[model samples]
Target: MYEMDGEEIFVIDGHVHLWDARQENIIHEGGEQFLQCFYDYHTGFTPEEEQWDIDTYRHYGADRMTEDLFGNATADMAIFQPTYLDDFYDEGFNTTEQNAELAEEYPERFVLNGSFDPRDGEEGLRYLEHLKEEYDIPGVKLYTAEWRDDSKGWRLDSDDAFEFLEKCADLGIENINAHKGPTIRPLNRDAFDVKDIDDAASSFPELNFIVNHVGLPRLDDFCWIAAQEPNVYGGLAVASAMTTNRPRKFGEIMGELLYWLGEDRVLFGSDYALWNPDWLVDQVMNAELTDEQRDEYGVELDVETMKKVMGENAAELYDIDIEAKKRQFRDDDITERFDLGTHYGGDAGAAAD
Candidate 1:
C-alpha cells in the first residue's frame, strides 16, 4: 500500500502479466513482432536508468516479478491479466497456467483472471468452464485481436462472442476485461474496435466491461460510449505510462474519463513489464491535471479520485476484502519473505533480495 499524503491508499494494479516471450516461445513471426512492440512501448515510456535489457524483457521470471510488484510494498495487490496467444506462440503467450505460477505462490496478493477464445467454439466454452472450475477466476482478459489459425480477429458484439459472454454470466463471472486498443502489434482497428463494446455492454448489463488502455486513438468514442454504459470502465494500462513524459495529455484523458465515466469507473494499471508498478504507481499518484485541462474538463485528479482508480474500484469489482487482506498481510508469506511485516505493523521494512 502506498502512503500518499499520510493516507494509506491500498494499491491494486488492475493489469499485470507473467509472460514468456523468449525466442523459444516465439513460434510465429507475429510472436517476435508482438514482444518487440511491447518492448518498444516499454522503452518509449520507461526511464532510461530503469529500462530492462531485451533479454530480461523477453523472459523475466516469477521471482523477479514478485519483487517488482510487492518487494517495495507500494502495491498491496495485483491482478493477472493473461494474454493467451496460442496461435502465435508454441506454448501460448501468458496462459492462465503461466500466470497461476505467481498467483498460486502469493494467492493473497494476486487475483488470477482467465482468458477465452470464442473461436474455440464448444471446446472454448469447456475451457472457460475449466478455468472457472480450476482457478475460480473472477474475471477474464480478452484479446479480441488475437490470431487464431488464419482468422485475424473477432468482434465483441459478434454472435459467437455473445455465447461466451452468456457463459460468463451463467458462471457468475462479472468482469469482462477487453483489450480495446491503440494498435499493439497484430492488433488493428477492425479487431480492436471500440464500437463493438457498445452493443456488448448494452447486451450484458450483468457483466462489467473494462476496456484496457481506454481505447486509445478512439478515446472520444470510448468516452461517449462509457458515458451511456454504466458497466463500462477504463483500465489505464498503456495510458498510465503516458503520465511520465505526457502528464498534460494523461490529465486530459483522465479529465475526459472523469467527466464521462466519473471517478469510479477509471482504474490504474502499469501493464507491468511494460512499466514497473514500483515507479509507475508513484508517477500516477503524483500526476495532476494542468490548469488549462482542469478548466476545460472541470475534473480533478485528486486523492479521493485516485484512491478509487488505484484500488477501491477494482476491489469492488473483484469483491476483495481490503481490510481483511491488510490484516492478513500482517504476517503473510510475502510479508515475511520481503520483511514487510513491520510495515504492516509486524516488523521493519527490507527490500526483496
Candidate 2:
C-alpha cells in the first residue's frame, strides 16, 4: 500500500513477468537480440541505481521478484503476463507453467495469466483448455508478434485468432491483454500494429481488450480506437517507464488516455523486471499535470484520479474487493517488510507486521 495526502492507496501491478533469458535459454541469435533489446530498455530508461547487470537480469528468479514487487515495491497483487518464445528458448520464455509456480506459492499475491498462439490451431485450443483447467486462469496475454515455425506473426483479427477468442469467451476468460509493443525476431514492425485490435475489440464486445503499453509509438491510433470501443482499455506498462526518463511525455500520454478512455478504463502496470514498482508508484503518486498539459489535453490529474489509476481500476476489472484485500494484507509478508522499513523506505507504523 502507498500513502498519499491522508489516504492509503492499494497498488496492483497489472503487468509483470518472471522470464529466463540466461545463456542456456538462448537458442539462437534472435534470442540473444531479444534479451539485449530488453536489457537496453532496462539500462537506458531505468535509473542507473536501479539497473542490473546482464547475468542478474537473465535469471532473476522468484525470490528476487518477490522482494522487488511484494517486499520492496508497493504491489499488493501482480498479474503475471507470460511471454513464451519457444523458438528462442529451451523451456520457453516465461511460460504460464513457470508463472503458475509462483502464483501457487503465493496465491493471495499473484494472478497467473495464460497465453495462446492462434497459429497453433486445434492443438493450441487444447493447450489453452488445459491451462484454464490447471490454473483457473482469469485472463490471457496475447503476443501477436511471437514467431512460429514458418509464419512470422499472427493478428487478433485473423479467423483462427477469432476462434481462440470465441473459445476464451465461452470458457469465461474476459480479459484479453494484447502485446502491441516493440518488434521481436522473425516479425516486422507491422506485426505490432494496433489496427488489428480495433477489429478484435469491435467483434468481441463481451471481452475486454486491454492494450498493453497503450500501443506505444502508435498512441494516437490506439486512443482513437479505444475511444469508440467501450470494452477497450489501456494498460500502462512501458508507458509508465517514461515517468523516470521522460515525465513530460508520460504526462502527455496520460492526458491523451484520460481524454479518450477516461479514468476508469486506464490501468497501471510497472512491467516489473524492466522496472520496479516502488519508484514507479512513487513517481506516479508524486507526479502532477501542469496547467499547460491540462489545457492542451483537456483533462485533470487529481487525487481521486490517481487513486483509480493506481489500483481501483484494475481491482474492478479483476473483480477484486480492494477494501477486503487490504484487511488481509495486515498479516502478509508485505506488511512485515513495510513495518521493518526494509523495503524502499516505507513507513514502519503504516500497518502492523
Candidate 3:
C-alpha cells in the first residue's frame, strides 16, 4: 500500500453500481428510471421515456462504470450494490445476477452490497439471510425512504423494515447505506425522506448508519444526526448536484462541511453510474480546500487522505479486511481479465481492477 513517498493509500470507492441489459427477467423502464435519476444530476441531461432501454444502461451505467473505475486509473477498492431495482416494477430496483458475477471476476476492487425491499416482508429477511450465507456481501443497503408510509412508499418504520434492520444488526453488519428521496421525478412532498429515521440509528447505536446523498435538502439534519449519534455517518456523493445545478456552491458548502465535521465523518463518493467518475472526483480534488482546512480536517493531499476518502473509513465502518480483499485480488487473475467499456479518458480514474 506504500508508494515511493512511503505514504500508504488504500482507496475503496464507497459508491458504485452495475447494470446490464442481457440478463434474464430484466426490466427496461426500470433501468431507464435509474438512468434518469443520474442524468437529472450528472449530465443535467435526461432521456425521454422512449429512448432509455437496456442499451442505455449498458452504455451509460454498466459499461461506463467499469471503464471509468477499472479501465483507467484505479482505486484500491470499491463498494457496490444495485440501484433503482426495488421501485419501478417486476424485478424492479435491483441489480441483476450478472453484477454478482462481475464481482466474482474482480473481487479485490469491488465489495458487493445486498438490497432488500421492505415490502418483501418476511421474504426479504429470508433473502437477506440467504445473501449473507451465499455471497460474500460486506454490507447491506436499505432505502428507508422507499418505505415512508405518508409518502405512499414502503415505510422504513414498518414492522417489516424494522425487523430487517434488526436482522442486519443481529448479523453484525456494520454499515447500511440508503437513499433519502426520489431521484428523478420532480421533488414531491410525498417523497420518502430519511430525516425522520434517526431513531433507527439511535435504536441501533452499534450499527454504522450511512445516510447516502447526505439527505439533500436535509443535509443539516444529517449533520445534526451525525453530531448527535456516533452511529450516523454522512456521504458526500454530490456528483450530480455538483455537475448540474451548484458546482461552485456545492464545493463551498462541502468545504465548510469538511471544516465543521473534520472530514472523517464526510466521505467522497461519486454516484458512478452517471457521469464520468473523473468529472466527480475532479470536482472535489480541485475544490478550494484550504491548507489549514485540509490539515484540520485530516485531509492530506497525499496517499493517506486519499485512502481514507476512497475506502479506508468504509472498510473500518463496514469491518471488511481490505488488505485481505486485496490479497484475494492479487491471487486471482480475474481483475486482469475483466473489462467494462470505454472510460472517461486516460489514467484519470484508475483503481485496482
- lDDT tens digits by residue: candidate 1, 110-138: 99999888999999999999999999999
- Computed on alpha carbons, the lDDT of every model, listed in order, comes to 0.90, 0.86, 0.58
Give the clash count for each candidate. 2, 0, 16
Q: Estimate each model's TM-score.
A: 0.96, 0.94, 0.75
Model 3 poorest ten-residue lDDT run: 340-349
Candidate ranking under lDDT, highest first, comes to 1, 2, 3
Q: Write the per-residue lDDT of candidate 2 for residues 1-353, one digit (tens) a residue.
A: 67777676778999999999999888978888988999998887788888898999998999888888876547778999999988888998899998987889888789899999998889999999999999999899999888777788888998999999999999988899999878686344486689999899999999999999999878989999999999999999988888887889889999999999999999999888888896788887777778899899888878899889989988887889887776666666656645534222234444346
- The residue pairs found clashing in candidate 2 are none
Candidate 3 wrong stretches, greater than 4 Å: 1-8, 20-34, 45-64, 84-93, 147-151, 181-192, 239-247, 290-306, 321-353
Model 1 CA lDDT for position 127: 95
Candidate 1 Cα errors over 4 Å, as ranges: 184-189, 347-353
Give lDDT: candidate 3, residue 248: 49
Residue 346 deviation, candidate 1, in Å? 3.2
What is the lDDT for 348 in model 1?
A: 51
- Report the C-alpha lDDT of model 3 over 222-294, residue by residue, as the tens digit: 6666677777776766633463445545655565555445556666666665444544454444444456555
